[model samples]
Target: MDIHYRADIKGGLLILHPAMGIVISGKVTIGKNLTLVGGNVIGFSTGINNPFIIGNNCSLGANAVIIGPIILEDEIKIGASACVIKNCINKGVTLVGVPAKEINKA
Candidate 1:
């Protein structure tokens, strides 16, 4: 796995699937129990040093991409192949689809 992350992760990080290409930027701040399924990319595409913040107990599904300047609050679930370019600050919300809209709140 080519996991390249130069950031701060507060607690545990779990990658569920056995795959390659995990890229996280240096400007990211991840909290506890960051459960990731399969390959994911968390970075800013604009080349600006925008901070990507993932709160505690968050789960990202396989092949998820978070292209930010965005903040995800605690206990959020991102579905497979979701592309989140905006912020999801509501805690315990489930996000899915290409632009990753909120499906429901848990």
Candidate 2:
């Protein structure tokens, strides 16, 4: 999907099929092979005042939420029902939990 300067998308990079429902807000950058479901939201957590940035090759699971200026590196994988509300991550890693922690390496 493509989100411009002030638009909102459910997720950054969702699948081409109907299953990947991508919703985003503000300035976000997405990658490849991302899959999402309905009701998924990726937007600015700071009440539409903050601009966000997401990295490449990342996958946000069903109902996954990404907020803040999150810079996810290449090949970053987020599990279903996960929420990210902070900093950034490296390349080739799996993130889970409420704050989206790195569980495994790629």
Candidate 3:
């Protein structure tokens, strides 16, 4: 797992299991209690300077990819192999599929 020096883990009880293959950019800001599975990629987009901001209690499934300057609100659940390119402002929901759309309100 490559978590850049500038990346901040603001919350407690964060878990990065099998941390291998997880790439987090320095410009990212992660909230508390995050559980990231293997093969997760959280970073910026091409030519974009803004950083990715992840809210608290988020769970990213295996092989999930979240790129670009986006905001993931609290309690967001990303499904396996999901790709999130936009901001997931809706809290307490499960997002799935390519370009990840909210599947369940939860």
Candidate 4:
């Protein structure tokens, strides 16, 4: 199955290297130069009012799930299968694991 929702995509967003599966639901805003790998699921955590906002030049690893109303700044890198609940990450950083911790500043 082609795991991508072109309809959910916005202007100037790029999805690349999807190695597994990608399911896009809810309201998602992806900035320019953004790349999502296969297995990266970008959508809402629940039937809430907020959605997910990914910053420019951001890269999501395979199986990474970004949910809720959160802000991922530019140049953000997410590890595979990482679960991001609700938080704001600074630019040039790498997040991993459940609840998504700031592993390193890239």
Candidate 5:
């Protein structure tokens, strides 16, 4: 997992698996207690804005791609192989499938 040096983790614990192929952009801001599984990408889309913001206690499953200038709120969970391109303002939600729709509330 290669997290860019300029990517900000604003305190608390971050659990990143060793086998995970996580790529985080330098302009990304991650909040506390983030758990990232394998093949997760948190980055900006090509020709899009930077500064992806993730809130606290968020968990990203395997192959989850969170791209562009999206904002993920607290306690959000992204399912495996999900692609998130928009802002998720609702907390405690579990997003799944392609384009990452909210399937359930945790």
Candidate 6:
């Protein structure tokens, strides 16, 4: 399991096992205690100057793709195989599926 992170992390970051392939670009900024399940990609530049931001205590599942210049608030959970291309305005929410939509965990 090889994990490559070239971003600015404010605190601790844990990339879990079974990490098939993980890549974090240099244009991203992550908060404290980020739990990455593996096989995930964060912030791959596509000529976009906006920086990708991740909040504290966030968990990104396996095969999760969070690209572009977007902001994810604190305590967010991104499900496996999820592709997020937008900003997560609310804090402490769960996002899943392609294009990544916020779901209510009832």
lDDT of 6 at 82: 98
TM-score of each: 0.89, 0.70, 0.89, 0.78, 0.88, 0.88
Lowest lDDT block of 10, candidate 6: 1-10
Local accuracy of candidate 1 as per-residue lDDT tens digits, 1-106: 5454678888798887756557777778899999888788887667666567999999888898888778899999999899998889899999999999999999
- Residue 85 of model 1 has an lDDT of 86
Q: Let me know the TM-score candidate 5 reaches against the reference structure.
A: 0.88
The lDDT per prediction is 0.85, 0.66, 0.85, 0.73, 0.85, 0.84
Any residue pairs clashing in model 6, and if so which? none
Sorting all predicted structures by TM-score, with the top scorer first, yields 3, 1, 5, 6, 4, 2
lDDT tens readout by residue for model 6, 1-106: 4334567888788888653777787778899999888888886658788768899999999899998689999999999999999999798999999989999642
Instruction: Give the Å shift of residue 23 in candidate 2.
Output: 2.1
Question: What does candidate 1 score in Cα RMSD to the true structure?
Answer: 1.6
Off by over 4 Å in 1: 47-50
lDDT of prediction 1: 0.85
Position 11, candidate 2: lDDT = 48
lDDT comparing candidate 5 with the true structure: 0.85
TM-score of 1: 0.89
**lDDT, model 2:** 0.66
Encode model 4's per-residue lDDT on 1-33: one tens digit a residue.
Answer: 243454244455566654466677646777777
List, residue by residue over 1-106, the lDDT tens digit for candidate 2.
4345665333444454444556666566555555555446777655454446665667777778887666667777788888988765577888898978889998
Clash counts for all predictions: 0, 9, 1, 5, 0, 0
Error of 6 at 104 (Å): 2.0
- Any runs in candidate 6 off by more than 4 Å, and if so which? 1-6
Model 3, which residues run further than 4 Å from truth?
A: none
TM-score of 2: 0.70
